[model samples]
Each structure stands twice: as structure tokens, then as C-alpha cells.
Target: MPALIVPTTRLHTAWLEAHDEWGPGSHEDGFGLRPSDEVDSPAGFAAWVARLGRESGQATIEAHRVHCTYRWIVEGDQVLGGIALRHGFNDFVQAAGHVGYGIRPSARRRGLATWALGRILDEARKHGMDQVLIVCAADNIASAKTIERHGGVPEGIRDTHLGPARRYWIKIGRTAT
Candidate 1:
């Protein structure tokens, strides 16, 4: 079974390979793709991984930044995908949501996203949050369906710097599916 693990260098190569195959990942909420040059070297990549892990675990963040936890969806030794769970909502988080995830292109259409998201929702519940928002690109039918399956109540589309996005609010532990 695939489980969510904290970002670690052990999965860096596998994660990098997956990202290379998929090209730049979904730039949801300013977590843009890593630069190609940086990902080219092992040391650089390891530092990058360490930085992201540290950034998320910070007890205090700048006003513009928020605490988030980065997790990898791994099945045994392979890193299949990732997710970011924001600690709380700011103006940016309000539009983006508490949870954002991406499955490698090769892993798409195999029910992985739905499963991984379900796991993330369980984590969110543990945080004692009443609700969380999840947003997807407006035309992303697959993502919309995944969110709906997790009890995502449509909050309508909103304009973003990238483009229009579909947003939904999920009440914790509701088990709509």
C-alpha cells in the first residue's frame, strides 16, 4: 500500500526521475517546479529536499509564508507522488486550499490520486480542522471528480495568477463517498 512519508533524500532520485518524466509539475499555490540545473546534481537536489522539509516544519514563518507539511506518496521504495498540507489559511491559502497533491503522469488514471487524497484527508482530520479547501484547474475533470469523491462541495471557480480554478470545501470526517 502507498503511504505518505515526510520528504527525504532517500526518495530524491526516484522523485526526480518521476518529475523529469512528467516535466514541470502542477504549480499550485506558488510551489513551482524545481529548476532543471538544480535537479541535475545529487548534492544540489539533496539540499533542495532538505530545504523544503525544513521550510514546512518551521514553527514560525514570515507573514507572507505559512507552515506546511510536504509528504511523499510512496509504495515501498518508489516515490509515486506528493502532497502539501498548509497549516492554516492566509489570503493565498484561502484560494489554494489546505491540501494540494500531484500524481506523476505515469501514475495518473490508476486511482492513485483518489486514494492518496483520502489519506491526506485523514491527516487533516487529525489536525482538528473543521474543514479544508481543495482547488483544481477549471478544466481538470479528473481532479474535480477526485475532490467530489472526497466530499468536496463546489464553492465555484475563482481567477488566479495562473488562470481560472475550481474550488471546493470539504468538511472533515464526513465520508461523503
Candidate 2:
């Protein structure tokens, strides 16, 4: 079974494999990758991973930044995908949502995204979030469906820096069906 795990240097090679499959782009959402991040070299990857942990450790929101928990989806030693659970809302979170996830192309049809989202929703609840905003590309049918399956209520489509996105809200602190 696939499990959510904290980002680790041990999975560097496996993580790179998944990263390469997405080709070259910052479009690999959920990994919290930025255009300026250099994850190619081992040292660079370690630094990037450290940054992720530091972001999560920031108890207080700073300026535009918010605490965010990052998790990798792994079954055994293979890195299949990643998910992010943002602790609070900000201008960026308003467009991106509190939860973002992506499964590698090879792992897309295995319900990994759905599974990861479910896991992160629990994390959000633990962090005292009453609800979470999740946004996906408006044209992404699979992501929309996955959200809906988890009791997400449609909040309509909105334009973001990344273009048109479908927004959803999932309530926490309640018994899940």
C-alpha cells in the first residue's frame, strides 16, 4: 500500500525519476517546486528538501508565506507522487487552495491522487482547519471527480495566475461518509 511520508533525501533518485517523467516545467504541482529551485544535483535536491521542511516548521505565517506540510506518496522504495497541505489561506492559497496533489503519469489511474487527498484532508483537520479550498485546472476532469468523491462542494471556476481553475471546498471536523 502507498503511504504518505515526509520528504527525505533517501528517495532522491526515485523522486528524480518521477520528476523527470513530468518533463521540464514548474507544472509539477503539489511538490511545491518553484522556477528558481534547482533539484537536479544531489546537493541541490537536499537543499530543496530542507526548504520544504523549513516551511513546515514556520509556526507563524510570514508575509505571504504560510506553513505547509509536504508529503510524498511512496509504496516501498518508489516515489509515485506528492501532496501539499497548506495550513492557512493567503493570496496564493486563495487561488491554489489548501490542498494540491499530483500523481506521476505512470501512477495516475491507480487512485493515488484520491488516496493522497484523503490523507491530507486528515492532516488539515488535525491542524485545526475547519475546511479546505482545493483548486484544480478547470479542464481537469479527473481531479474534479476526485474532489467530488471526497464531499467537495463546488465553488465555481475562477481565473488564477495559472489560468482558469475549478475551486472546491471540503469541510472537516465532521464524520466523513
Candidate 3:
């Protein structure tokens, strides 16, 4: 079974395997990986994990980022994917949504995204969020279904800096069956 755990340096090798599978890009949405992040080395990866921890409790205005929690989807020693739960709303949150996730190509079709989203929703509720927005690429049918399965209500599609995406709103207090 897969579980969501806070990012840690111990998973460095496993995380790199999953990251390699995504090929070369910053598209691993939930990892909160920035272009400046030097995750190739142990020290760099540890620093990145530390930065994520620091961002979890409050917004880092100097970095132009919001408060958010990052969790790795792991099954035993293997890293599968990641999910992010934003604590509050902002222009970026409005466009990107409160949650974002991505499962590695090798791990797709295993319902990992749905499971991770559900877990992250619980985190959002703990953070006192009554509702959360989630957006997926407009063409991503699989992702849409995952959101819908969690009681996500359609909020239409809109163009983002990344491109057009379909948005959904999930009421956090509602049963996320």
C-alpha cells in the first residue's frame, strides 16, 4: 500500500529514481521543485527538503511562495509520486489550486493520484480549509476522473501560464469517498 509521508533526505535514491522517470523537466508538479533547486546532490536534496519544511507552516514572502505541505507517495522503499497541500489562497493558489499531484509514468493507472489527493485533503481540513480548488490539464482525462471521484465540482477551464486547465472545487468538510 502507498502512503503519504513528509519529504525526507532518506528517500534520496528512491526520489531520484522517480524523478529520472519523469525525464528532464520541472513538470513534477507536487514536488515543489524550483529551477534553482540543486537536488542532484545529497546536500542539495536535503536543503530542498528543509526549504519545503520551512514553507509548510507559513508563507515565505521573500521567495514569493505560499505556505504549503509536501508529501511523497511511497510504498515501502520505493518513491512513487508527490502531492502538495496549500494552506491558504492567493493569486497563484487561485490559478494553480490548493492541491497538485503527479505520479510517475511507471506508476500511473494505479489510483495513486486519487489516494494521494484524498490524504492531502485531510491535511487541508486540518489546516482549517473549508474548500479546496484542484486543477488538471484540460486534456488529462485520468486526472479529471480522480478529482471527480473525490466529489470535485466542475469550475470550468481557464488558461494558466502553463496552459488551459480544467478546475474543480472539492468541499473539504464533505465526505471524500
Candidate 4:
């Protein structure tokens, strides 16, 4: 099984491959580096890693108005996907929800996102969070179903600046199936 480990310098070497796998219009939401980030070379990617997460084995990153922790879903040496857990909910988070996640384009429809969220929910339990809010686009049935499979209850839809989105809440510490 893959594990949700904090983003680390050890995986910076995999950045280029992962970045290329995203393709056009893929979800770059939880990716620590932005489309504009300097990742031309290994050294540049390593430097980008410093500001995003898991520096020296811990997530000390502070961005997007929350104490955010960026984690990579990996199996052995391969970077499969990523998930973001925000410690605090801001106005933007209130509508977008607490958890944001994505699987690489090449690895989609393989049950990775659901599995990633399961592991992320375990991490959430450690933070003493009782429930986790997950948001997905109304048109994104795959994401919505993944959320539902994890016991996420629909909390209705909202028209946000990000467009129409569906919100859900999953109770933490719920036994994993």
C-alpha cells in the first residue's frame, strides 16, 4: 500500500516526472509548486521544496491563509498523487472545504484518490479533528463518488468564486473499509 508522507526533498528528484504527468487542465491544487515555480533543474526543484513542505522531516509551511500540510501519496519510489490538509478554515476554505486532493493523470481511476483521502483522514484524526470537509465540483462525479465512498455526507452545493461546487463532511476516526 502507498503511504501519505509529508513532501520531502528526497522526492524533489521526482518532481519533473510528476509535473509532466499532470498534463493540461489537470488539478494542480495541492501541488506545492505553482505553474510559475522555478523547477527547471534538480537544484531549483529542491529549493522550491524548501518553501512548500517537509523540510527536515516536518511540515513547517504556512501558505494560503492556513497551516497547511502537503503530503505526497507514494508507493516505494514513485510519486502517485498528493493531498492537502488545512488546519484552519478561512473564507475561501469555508466554501472549498478542508481537504483538497488529486491523482496524477496517468494514475486516475485506479482508486488512488479514495485511498489517499483515507490516509489523510487518519492524519486528520491525529490533529483532533472530528470531521473533515471535502469539496468537489458538481460536475466531477468521480470525485463526488470517491468522497461518498469514504462516508462523506452531502452538505449541499454552493456558488463560489471557484464556480459551482459540492461540499461534504466525513467523520474522522471512522473505521476504514
Candidate 5:
């Protein structure tokens, strides 16, 4: 089975390779973008990752280290996609979740999202999140289905800074692993 690999400094080359494949318009590319445009390289990503680790403790943003960033790599070699898990509060309840994921465009419709999210949900439980709030765009039917498949229960939908988002909650022990 494919496993979730945490991103690390040693995998910078892999990250670079994936970034090149996905390019700037992809959601994965958004992770590399910053306000100052200074974070534009491997070294910059490493620094940014380190900074996010530090900031996660002080700020409400629970963005974890890449080691904590879960990925679904087939045969443990091909990185299909991943979920960026960041801890959250009230705002996150309405918009963001503890996790955000995307499959490579070429790898879509292959059940990677369901697998990746199932793994991330396990990680959330390991991190002491008894209940997780997962939100996706109301219009994102695919994502909604993935969420539902993973046992997410519709809590409500709300408007946020980005747009309309549907919020779902999963109680860790309620579902069998």
C-alpha cells in the first residue's frame, strides 16, 4: 500500500521536481508563494518551512512541519498528492480545516484523495484532535464526496473570506479504523 510521507529537507529535490511539474497555478504551488516574493527557491522553502514550524506554536495557525505534512506516494516512490494539516480555531471552523490536500492533475480520479485524507484523519487522532473540522468549497463536489466517504458529517455551510465553504466534522472514535 502507498504510505503518507512527511516532507523533509532531504526531500527538497523531490519537492522541486513536484513543483516544476505542477507549476504556479496549481494549489500546491500556493504553498511556495509568499507576500514578499522572497520565498522562491529550495533554500527559501526550507526557511519558510522552518518559520512555519516556529510560528505554529505562537500563532493560531497550526501549520505543522513538513514531516507532519502527509503525502500519498505510490510504492513509496511516486508522490501523488498530499494534505497540509494546520491546527485551527473559530475561523478555521468556518473556513479552513485541520487539513488541506490535492492530487496532481495527472493523478486525479484515482482515489488518492480518499486515501490521503483517511491517513491524515488518523494523524489528527494521534495529535489529540478528538473531533476534526474539514471544510471544502460548496461547489467542490469531488472534495465533498471524498469527505463524505471518509465518514465526515455535514455540520453546516458558511460564508468566509474566500467564499462559501461546507464544514464537516468527524469524531475520531466514532468510525472503525
Candidate 6:
């Protein structure tokens, strides 16, 4: 329950451990919900972290930017999950969201996803997002509950790159207490 969000570099070792634990292609079930690829490799992951640190500007499909990826850390050490806060309409409304996350399998059911998302929402508000969109697989009850617990209202369902996904939105101006 300590700070759930941290710099990806702060938990690089833990990120690698969680990736190993979840195995390849595990991160795909969340976010864009696609299999791990070259960008998911250890070195690629490090570069991604560096990009987040740069915060130079918004990213484009052809160009990348920093601050797009955020990691959820547990106990200020272990990485339980992460989300890529992509900018622009395509990312905001489709591929990614104001946030997306996944708890490591071994760490599931401990409310980490809930806590992680709550933290992410706060970040969204800080970024001036009035409402944040979060989408999860329709069958992912755990993720649905986590979203609901964080004040996400069922906005609708949509077919995404990963198949049927439930879309939820949370008003960032309000914090769950």
C-alpha cells in the first residue's frame, strides 16, 4: 500500500522478475493486450524506461515520447503491474488509455490491481485529464472489479485490437476515499 506508482527504472529488477513470472505474452492480456515483442525485451524495456524519463514530448506512431509508460510498484520495490498512458485520441480512446495495468499472476487477488489503478488515476488527474478511459476484457472479472472499485463507471463495450473489451471511465476530479 505504499506508493503504488514509481519510475520504471526504480523497479527494473522487479519488472524483469514480474515479466519472467508472467512469462512472454502475458502483458498482452492487458493494455493493448498483445504479446510481448522486441519492445518487451529486457534491453527494450530499459529503453522504454529511458524514454519515460525523457518526457520530451508526446509520442506518435512514427515518433516516440517519454512519460507514456508508467509502472505500478508494490512496497516501493516490487513491480506488480504497469500501464502505458498513451497520448492522443487513437491511444486514449482505443489502444491504450489514461492508464492500463496488470498484476503479476502470483500477486493477484491481493487488491494490488485496485490500488495500482487508484494511483494511476491520480496521475491522470495531475496530467489534466478530466476523465480517464480504461478498457478491460469483458471476461476479466477481476479487472472489472478493480476498475469499479476505483470509481470507474461502465461507459460501454467495444471491439478492440484484442477483441471484446469493456470500457470504463472515471472522473479524475474526484478521488475515491
- For model 3, what is the alpha-carbon lDDT of residue 121? 90
Ordered from best to worst TM-score, the candidate numbers read 3, 2, 4, 1, 6, 5
Better of 4 and 5 by lDDT: 4
How well does candidate 3 match the true structure in TM-score terms?
0.92
- Please identify model 4 stretches exceeding 4 Å from their true place: 56-63, 173-177
lDDT per residue for candidate 6 within 43-137, as digits (tens), equals 87656555444244223333322235444556657766655565435544554555667777887888777776776666666666678778888
Candidate 4 lDDT over residue span 47-105, tens digit each: 67766655633343344556667788888878888888876667656866778888877
What RMSD, rounded to one decimal, does every model reach?
3.9, 2.8, 2.9, 3.2, 4.7, 4.3
lDDT of 5 by residue, 1-177 (tens): 666664455555555566567776555611323454344576776765564443332222333322334343443456566576554445443356766777766777988888878877876776666777788888989999998998899988888777898989878753434
**What would the TM-score be for candidate 5 when compared with the true structure?**
0.73
Task: Candidate 1: give its CA RMSD in angstroms.
Answer: 3.9
- Model 5 scores worst on lDDT over the 10 consecutive residues at 57-66
TM-score, one value per model? 0.84, 0.92, 0.92, 0.85, 0.73, 0.74
TM-score comparison, 1 vs 3, better candidate: 3
C-alpha local distance difference test of each model: 0.74, 0.85, 0.87, 0.77, 0.63, 0.62
Model 1, 11-105: lDDT tens per residue?
A: 76787777776665444222223444275577877766665664453222244486766777788888788777776889868877787888877
Span of 10 residues, lowest total lDDT, candidate 3 = 54-63
Candidate topping lDDT: 3
How would you encode candidate 2's per-residue C-alpha lDDT over 32-113 as one tens digit per residue? 7777778889999988888888445322234458778889899999999989888767886887888889999999989999
Worst 10 residues of 4 by lDDT: 54-63
Model 5: pairs clashing at backbone N, Cα or C within 3 Å = 62-87
- The lDDT, on a scale of 0 to 1, for candidate 4 is 0.77
